[model samples]
Structure formats: C-alpha cells, structure tokens
Target chain A: MSLNESLDALRAKMTSEAAGAYEEVLQRLDPRLLAENALKPGDVMPNFELPNAEGKMVSSLELLSHGTLVVTFYRGSWCPYCMLTLQALDLILAPVPGQQASLVALSPETGGRARFVKDKYNLRFELLADVDNAVASMFGVLVRLPPLYRQRLLSQGIESETLHGRKGWFIPVPSTFVVARNGTVAHAEIHVDYTRRTELDTLPLVLRALRQYS
Target chain B: MDLPQIGYFIVLSRVLNFTHAARECKITQPALSRAIKRLEWELGGDLLLRERSLTQLTEFGRAMLPLLEQVQAAADVARDEARQLQTQERAPLRLGLSPWLAFPLIGTVLREVIASVRSTEFSVSVEAEPVMRERMLRGDLDVLVGLRADTLPERFNQWQLFSTGAAVFLPRDHLLAADELIHGSRLAESVLLGASEPEALPERILSQIVRRLGRRPSTPHRASNWETSLQLVRSGLGLGLGLSCWPTPPELVARGLADRLPDYEVVVETIAGRPQSRAVSTFVKLARASAWMNPANVP
Candidate 1:
C-alpha cells in the first residue's frame, strides 16, 4: 500500500480519544508556525552532526557532498505514521538514473529507541538521535507537547526517560527537506498534522531536479 | 588510545575528509564516523570542529593530539616488543572511570598494577556516568570504577570502594570562602559555573540544588569542563562545584557543602558472573589495597 493509504488505515484504527490526544499535542504549537512555510528553496540548510542508531555522528554536509540529501524529521517510534514513512522510504526511495542520494531520519528519541526502530524495519538509511530536538528547533520544526498530552502518553506506558533519555516533551512537526550539493534547500515539507507526510514517489523527481541544480 | 579510533582520527587529521579517510583506512565511512564519535564520547569533548564548509581540530582536539599520538607510538613499540619476545600479545585493559570519582586513587593504583603485572597495558576512558554505563554495557569497557552501588543494575557485581563528601570551589577572597561550608542560599546568589560538555552535572545533584534554592541557579558563565571552570573562576567570574575532585590551586578554597546533598558511596563494578581475567583481578585487588582508599584521604 502507498504510505498515505497505510497512514489512513492507522488513523482509522485509533479511537476518538487517542486521535484527540495527538491533536492536543499539536495544538500547543504557535498558530502561525502551523500556517507558515519553512526552509524555502534556495535557503541554506544548517549544518548538523547527530549520532545515528549505532551512535555514529552523521553530518548533513557529509551526506550532501555525496549528492542530494533527503532528511526526514519524525516524532518518535511510537507514531505508526512515522514508522510507515520510514518503511516506505526504505522500500521505495529509488535514486534517479545517474544520481546519488542519501537519506537520514531525525527524532528526539534516545539512541536505544533509534536502534530499535532501525533494526525492526531493517532500514537502509540512518536514524539519528536529535537529542532534545535541538536540530529540529534549528529547522523550525520543533513543538513542545502540552503537559496534559505528555501525561496522557506517559500513562499509556510510553515513559519519557526510556524513549527520550530525559523528561523532554518536545517533538518535531515531521518534516522533509531535499538538500542539493551546495546545502541549499531544494524542497521543504512541514506537516503540522503529522499524519500527512511526503509522498515517497515524488522524492525521486525532486532528486532529479536537485541533480540538475548542481 | 582506542587504537582504531586513534588510527582513524590520525588519518582524518591528515586528509580532513570522511570519504578519503575511510578509504585510506579501508573501512566504511560510517565506521570511521562511529569510531570518532565513540572516541569523542569517551574523551568527553568534540575532537573535531565541523562547520558548514570547514572541518578542523577543536582546541580540545589539538590538546589531545600529541598525547594520543604518543600512545599510538608506544603501542607500536609494545607490539614489536611482544613479537621479538615470541610471546602472545594481550589486548590492553579497557578501563572506564566515572567522571565524579577522584582521580588520585586510580593513578596510584594503576602505577602499582603496571609495576607488578608483566606486560600490562591500559587504555582508560574517563567520562560522565551515563556514558560510562552505556560503554560498560556495550563491552567497550571491562571494569568501571566509582559507580554508586544503588544506581547500578543487578547485572554488575559492585564492591564498595570509598566514600567522599561533595564540595564547591571559590576564589579565596570571596565572602562565601570565609565559611568552611557554603549554604545553598549563598550559592544561589552567585553565578554557578559547571561542566556541560561530556555531560552536565548529575540530575540528582542539580535537582537537590534547585529544591534547596527554590529556583534554578543562574549561570552567567558555564564551563565545558573543570579546567575551563577554574579559568573562569580565576578571572573572578564565578565559583565551581566539584564534579570529580577539588582543584589543586591554592588560590581557590574548597568548601564542603552545608546543604542536604548526600554523600557518595562509590563502588567498583564489573559485569556479574563473567569470568574475570587474571589481569582484571590483579587490577581490582590493587585498587582495594591502595592507600587512597584510607578513610583519612577521602574529601
């Protein structure tokens, strides 16, 4: 199934209360941030080096140097939509002919969770520990979860210390950026309603244009 | 030196490119990256400063360069010496010390252990508690020193080492220095300098300080490590809380905290039920008998 279809299926399964809890978390964000675009085309993507699942430091510039870079910022492993997006990217993200592209996902979750999700999916790309959503905040995708919603999640057995290495209640807006060789953002997508995600099929076309940009 | 990380970093220091460095070392780029990351995690600072267009050694990296190179050279000499003697070359003992532990005890113990044990070598990593714990679980470390017995998992066999009271350092002329013990209220009034790089001061201590002061302490000048904290304090910036040990400087006075913070009952820990090699046992025995463990020496 397509990633959107799978996401819709997961959304269909959640009860009203669970769905409302997710919405309440997003509701805490500034209204303007939800309405605005982020990291527009031609803007220089900030440099970052974060530890991957194996605790390796993955650099944005190092990835970009290889060719186009596809960076996905997800909420955490607990979100099924993020999991589906990761699987789709791993399975369907074929490079355009004569193009070299590297994919990486970022989450504020700790290294252990990153490793768990990466191993479970058998993903090809690296899952980096953003560590307190510092990199996500830099990209303007970070949102602090409302304390009530945070408590709701904790009550459901998803403890903060286990997942995030601390009591950090912040999460990214679930973003995607296609970065070109020179570190310019070629395409940016920020989903306030995180159920919405980048279409994996469209990523190759963006990469094709990025290949031409360089 | 972590030989592989030392080798990878030495190559990268020359080439300054991940692809080139990995290629020269005949390893994947990610492996090289992980080695450097692990090395940085163990050392408690970033060895390389990676800006958008620039990659170079940081001040900490530069400071560590010659020392790491000397270790690499010494290892080379040891490797050849083992070959000439027709003896089996044993891997160096990978020892990890908690950043909160006093360093003097370990130094004396290691000195005696090396003198007695034939061909004994050591690669020590001194990092913050969580990092040390993670490394220990990953088998990156064989023996860990200075873990609280209560804090460790049941999988580790912990033995009592020594107990020490916590203290803070201030310039001798500071008004707070007049008291042998500094209270939380007086400390809250001044800017607090602390180590934040490898890891922040333990949450346990920070939370107690917060409770005692009834607010977060303002840190106008935070330090990356104790050395920088001393430098900042020496410049009349702020006082420092001891993470590991009291500063050796006579200009600074070390006052025990008069607040409700608990004493540390540090223990030596190793993987439970695992067969301890002769060298590890010898090292542990030497540690137990060390003069630093004497009751009078603590503090």
Candidate 2:
C-alpha cells in the first residue's frame, strides 16, 4: 500500500480524543512559509557532517561522491509516520547501490534511538543523528513545536528532550532532498503536514535521470 | 507568458504522474494540472490522455516535446547569461577549483595572480571536478582548475598545468613501510582504508589495485576524505591510497606503487568559443607563465 494510504489506515484506528489532539496540533501549526522558503531544486545544498547510529561521522560530500544522494529528514524515530516512511524507503532503496546512488536518513533523535530504529527496520542505509537539528535548520526544515502541543505530547509520556537528548522541543518538518553529485539540490520535498512524504519509487527515477543528464 | 509552465509540462510528460511532476516543480498537483489545462487551451489541443491508472501524451504532445525541450534549453541559456552578467558586475572573477589539486601549489599560484592583477575581485569555490564543469557550462564559473581523465567536452578549452602520480600510504610501524615500493601482491592480506564513497578517486585507485592483484583486500574502514583516510592509516586501522604530492603526516609513510598508475593532469579550463572576460584571460596568462605549471618546480 502507498504511504499515505497506510497513514490513513492508522489514523482511522486512533481514538477520537487522540485524533482531536492531532487535529488541534495540525491546526495550530502555521505552514505559511514552510514549504515556500524551504530549499528547492537548483539551489546549492549546504554540506554537513553528522554521526551515524554507530557514532561514525558521515558527510554530505561522501554521500554525493557515490552519485546522487537521497537525504531524508524526519522528526524522530518515535513518529509512526516516519517509521513507515523509513521502512518504505528501505524496501525501495535496496537496489540503490546498483543505481549508483546513496540514501541517508536524518533525525533529531539520539544515536541510540537511531540505532534502535535501524536495527528494528533492518535498514541497509545509513541513519544519522542530527543531534540538535543543526543540519535540519540548514535545510530550513527545523520547526519548534507549539507549547500546547508539546504539553499534550508530554502528558502522553512522549518527552522530546528525553528521546532526542536535547532541551529544545524542535523537530524538522519531514522533508527529502535529492542532491546531485554536483552538490545542487535536484529535488526537494518539504511537507509541513507530517502525514505526507515523497513517494519511494520516485527517488530512483530521479537518480536515473540525473545520471543520464549529467 | 508562463514559460515555467511549459517546463512543468515537459517534466509532467516525463514522469507521467501529476503528483510526482508537481513535487518536482515545487507546486501543488492541482496547480500543475491547471497549468497544463491552460497550456492546452492556449495551444488549442489536448496534450495529454488522462486515465485512472495510465497517463500518456496525445499525438500533439509527442510532436511538441522536442520543440518544448529546445525552448526550455534556450530559456535556461538566456537566464544563465543574465545571471553571469550580474555576477561579473560585482566580482570580476568567479573561479572554481577541484579538491584533488595540491592545495599549497594552487594557493601560491592564486595569490601571485591576484596580487599581479589590480582591481579584479576574485571569488572562489572549491568543488569536485564534475560540479566545476557544470558551473563552467552554466556560466556560473569563470575558470576551473581540475583533472580530466579523457578528452574534455568540445565546449571547454583546457590547458595542461602539471601531472601527479599516486602512492600508497602505510603506518610507520607497518611491515610494508620498510619496502621502497608497495605492490598489489603485498596488499592481498592487508586491510585497505579508503573513502566511503565508491566513486572517490582513492577508492577507484584501490579497486584498480584489487583488480591487478586478482584478490581483493579487506577494507574495514572507509573514511569521508583524504584527511580521514590518512588518520585511519595513522591509527593503525588500515593502509590508504593517496596522491603522491599530498603532504604526508608524521605517523605514516608514503611509497610509490609497484604497478604504474595513470598520471592525472591538472588543467585550467574555460568555456570554449566564448569571449573571455579580462579577469579570466589575465588569470590564464598568469597560469601559463607560472612556475607551478612545471613539474620540476613542484615539491
């Protein structure tokens, strides 16, 4: 099933009270400049180096050096939508090496949490911890959660600080960037609505086109 | 008036999915659909055959595809030219160099050239060779300093600067450190340290060695850059492959490879058949006259 359809199925199973809280959070979140101001195709992507789940440093140049790079940013592994997206990506990206491309997912979660998700999903790609969302901010995906929403999540036993090992209640709007080997963003998809994401199959097609064009 | 809409149409034609094409164009699916509809209205024909599961172009769309591609390419050239004009108004020279070049040599050459040429503001970008070539083609870069494995594209005019060889770097305490030249046969059992990216030059060189040896070495650690690769060698993790001219750290020893590796020529490249700006021409002139272009002068 498609990622959106899966998300819709999960949403249907949520209690009305939980559903209402999610709706309230989404309503309070302002997405006015989020998508428009985010990075776009033809823009130069900022180079970054972050620690992977195993604490080894991975850099943007290294990923791009292979071929086109697919960089996906998620709020954290705790988000079910993000997990579903990661699993979908893992399935589709199994043949990425054959396509001469690399995939790396970034999250504000700690290395431990990233490792947990990586092991749980049996992900073949590198999953890096963005630490304090510094890399996400560079991509213009960082957003501070509304106070009431943070309170609601905290009351539900979801503490961002404890999960991410950071004090800020910040998360990156789920986004994906297809960066060419030239370090230019060939495609960027920033979805302020967390339920949406770039389709998995489309990424390999973009990589193939980039190789052909270059 | 909506040239970008036409470009979007071209993208949609390729992807055959409104949602995918809209995401590529950074617009909503409805917006892209509306744009296509407006285009069809203006052209007086339906360009696409839409269905629940299948999206294909009609007869008119097939005929318009090549023409639209040419139009988009021409528009891009125009925009690139305008952007280049604006850039030159502020900085006379926007130079890009490849990271593989010996930094000290290029640094010295650039310093000498910039000092000799007065009132010419220079902005520099250090990037990979492919990126530099793309920027040069797009008119974003005035000149490029990089290596070419084969014949360059006809659009680029290139002048050979200097050539460099490759070497294998091993830890100081390694058994191979005592040898004057390291051979692929000797590295059969040793672990190789290389850049994580498969396309990196060092990794390519390592693969070449593996091919020659007929047996692959165990590569346990892959780094992101030359520095990291060297560090891995110094930390006794594995041996590394690097350019002969790169400065060696105190904890490692660099030796010539027994197998003759191909020599890469560092060259200065600019767009061919295009009128050169004063800054570009002057820099080229200085580069030709510079001692750094001669192999004998290089350390």
Candidate 3:
C-alpha cells in the first residue's frame, strides 16, 4: 500500500475509536447533530469572495486561478488549534507544484483580529475575513455555540463586540478543502467541535493524491 | 491637592533655586515659582525659605518631602494593581498549534482546562509563526507553542517541551526508501510536498536540499494542512518533510535525511507580566506530560 492508503486506514481506525468514545460524550454535544456536508473528491467548488486582513477583496476565481487552491476555514485567530494547524500548513507549502495553488485562510475575524494570526504565527499565506460567516453558512459549516459557553466567553471579554465590534457572537466549524484548477475539490476535512483539528502531516499525502487526479 | 506641584515644591526646596529646579523639571523658572507657591498655599504654610539672594527648605518643607514621597509610592502601587485588574478582566489564553496536532489535542486540552479552572475564563486562539511571537509581544496572547529562539522577549517566560526531528515522507514503493539516507539532489527531481515556508521544518534541511540542487525545487506543491499533505504524498504526487514527534501511518515512510535537521524545540511560553490562569497552567502541564518534557533543558 502507498503512504496515503496506510493513512486512510489509520484514519478509519481513529474514527472508529472516536465513535465509541463519542457514544458517551454525545450528551454534551448540541442537540442538532452536525450536518454532513463535506465536499467530495470531485465536487465542484462554489464561488466565494471575501476580504483579506486589510479588508481588500479576494474571490474564489482569483484564488482558484492557481493550478491548485488550498482553502482553509478557521474559527478565529483566537483558536489555538487553528493557530497550530495553520502554522503547520505554513511549514509545508512546497512540493505540490501540480496545481500551483494559492493557499487562503478565511475566518470571521477582520482587520486586527485577522492580522493577529499572521502577527502572532508569522504565517505568510493570505488570511481573509469571512465577515459574517455568510460564506461559511452557505457551506453549512456554521454552528451555534452552546448558550452557557457563549456567556462564558462573554464573561472573559471575548464577546462579539471585542472580536468584531458587534453584539452577536457567532462561530463556524473549522473546515478545509483542496480544490484543483478546474474548481473540483480533491480532498476536504471538517471538524465540528473546537478542540480537534486536521493533522498537519496528512496534507502532503492529500496534495499528492490531488496531483494524481489532476 | 495638586501633588505634582507639591513634588515640584519638594525638588525646589532641595535645589534652593527656581532657575535650577525649573531646568530639572523641564519647565520655565516662572512656572517653578508658581508651582511652589501653589504647594505652599495648598498646605496653608510656607514650606520654602525664599529670599532674593538665597533659598532653602523650611523645617516644615523638609519634613513634608518624605511624607509626600511615601504617598506617591502608595499611589503608584494602587495604579499598578488597577491595571492588573483591568488586564485580568480581559484575560485571554492564546494557544498555538500545527495543523496536524490541532484536532486530536484540542478537545483533551480544553477538557482538562475546564476541569481545572473554575473561576477564570479564557479565549483560545490558533496562529502561525511570527504572529505568535508578535502577539506575545503586543500582549494579545498569553502563551504559545513556537520556535524557540535564544533570546525571548524580556518580559516573557518559556518552557521547552521537546525537540522534534524532521523526516523525509515517502511512499512505501519510492526508490529512495531502499537507501539508508535520502540525498538533497534526489529530492529536487521528485515532486516536493511542503508548507508555505519553513516554519516548522528545519531550515537546514530545506536550504541544504535547495543549495545542493543549486536552484528552487522543480515541482513544488503546497498543502494547507498536514492531513492534506499526507494525502498528496500517498497519491504519489511528491514526498513530504515532517516532524518525528507523531507516528506516521503504516504505509508512508518517514526517514531522516543524512545529517539531520535541527529546526526548533516545541515550547510553551507566556507574556512576562501577565498573570497565569489556572487553565493555562493545566494545559501546559498536560502538554509537557504528553510530549515528555525534559526539565534539564529548560532555558
């Protein structure tokens, strides 16, 4: 088996383990189970336009114009998992010359909050502000925080006002997709909760598969 | 009372000259005189012995200086405490992660944090490279996992967890896997899978490979996350460079190139002046335990 096959097998085993543990933790999760809407290997990506940290506009077309496009959606700059994951991705940008893809990260954070990722992690990829998570909602990845957790965040002064100068605090589930030049998603991963994240080591394997498919 | 004016009075009383005291205070001579007069009026007593040719502090002025200094010192302490309270009110726990580690680690870490911290609340964030350092400097993030530099910010404290080695990620069938050591020139012709720059991978490995080849990589591709990169590698798009800290899946081969690369020691660092939260402390402890932290190497 190739490296990708072994990883897939390992992933399957982990998912099964998580499923068993999930039986117990399911009670703590939101009643509305997360919708299964992940992009498939050959699914066409929808067009999206969002602002960069400077509030300058960027679109899916422009981003996809590169031979390959690596797009990641983050909860915000404040998430440690997002930080680590992005930093890891920053470390592995070469080797996928097949698509000549541009890497873009989108989040609800704008201006300073958006810039915080780059300022803090020293990441060079384009960090975009998804504004209201409108695009994320369209992708069906937006989820509401449990009411108690929402209040807890507010007590710590991370309310919407502090993050975006608004009263409503909304966050999206973190997701990532590898889109080929033709706009088809070659690989995608989405996590519902705040804690778990996509492993950084698997990116190269996915890119290699993408190159094969392309 | 206008304490600064009183302070001026104390300084003038010592110097015994409005001209000299004004220069020291960065004010005009007339301003110094007015300040001293105001201090005397506020105290309802003459605190300075002033004559045309000679000036001195009266006994009352001399006695008052030490008392005023005490009051000022107390005020400074109060101001500092108030600032601390404000910061505590806005306390945030910024945590950094590489894409590979985020998902599996986040849930457990936060669950550990919530169990330990009942009073203090926190906001967790993820960030990439230089931003983690910059945010720590700007007082935005309280702690992070980043490259360990010889010199950290003066006000920050760092804990070294462990050093992760970089490896060449290849498919099981790759010809190079048969060789004990992967060479730089061999990596050039093969499609290379990498992140944007060398934030986590050792700089030496990347530079050596490029330097030995004498140019940029021939067919380089970027992956936003490690999982994707691994997927790309498995599909035979190219090879990968990654940390040995985590186990590679059974199919892929992760081997250290000859003359291994020394990239960074994973560390948990905090802003110098910020007070540590219970959650932050607990998370650090667990991270140390999980990564087999060594105390002997603490910098």
Best by lDDT: 2
Interface CA RMSD, all predictions: 18.5, 21.6, 23.5
lDDT of 1 by residue, B1-299 (tens): 13556778888888878888999999998988887886665455688987766679989788767545534542343333323234434535678876555566567667655554456678888777667777878777878886474456657755454556666777889999899788888888888775574344433455578887899677666664456667778888877766435445778888888885876656666775454443454455445333233323321
Question: Lowest-scoring 10 consecutive residues by lDDT in candidate 3 chain B?
Answer: B290-299
Docking category for candidate 3?
incorrect
lDDT-better candidate, 1 vs 3: 1
Rank candidates, TM-score, best first: 1, 2, 3
DockQ of each: 0.01, 0.01, 0.01
Q: Could you tell me how far off, in angstroms, the CA of residue A60 lies in candidate 3 after the best superposition?
A: 56
**Candidate 1 positional error at B149, Å:** 10
For model 2 chain B, give the 10-residue run with minimal summed lDDT.
Answer: B290-299
- What would the per-residue lDDT of candidate 2 be over residues B9-116, giving only the tens digit for each residue? 999899998889999999999989987886665344678999988889999898766545534442343333334433443327788876555556556555654553
Question: Cα lDDT for residue A49, model 2?
Answer: 56
TM-score of each: 0.45, 0.42, 0.37
RMSD of each: 20.7, 22.8, 25.8
lDDT per model vs. reference: 0.66, 0.70, 0.59
Please state the CAPRI-style docking class of candidate 2: incorrect
State the TM-score for model 3. Answer: 0.37
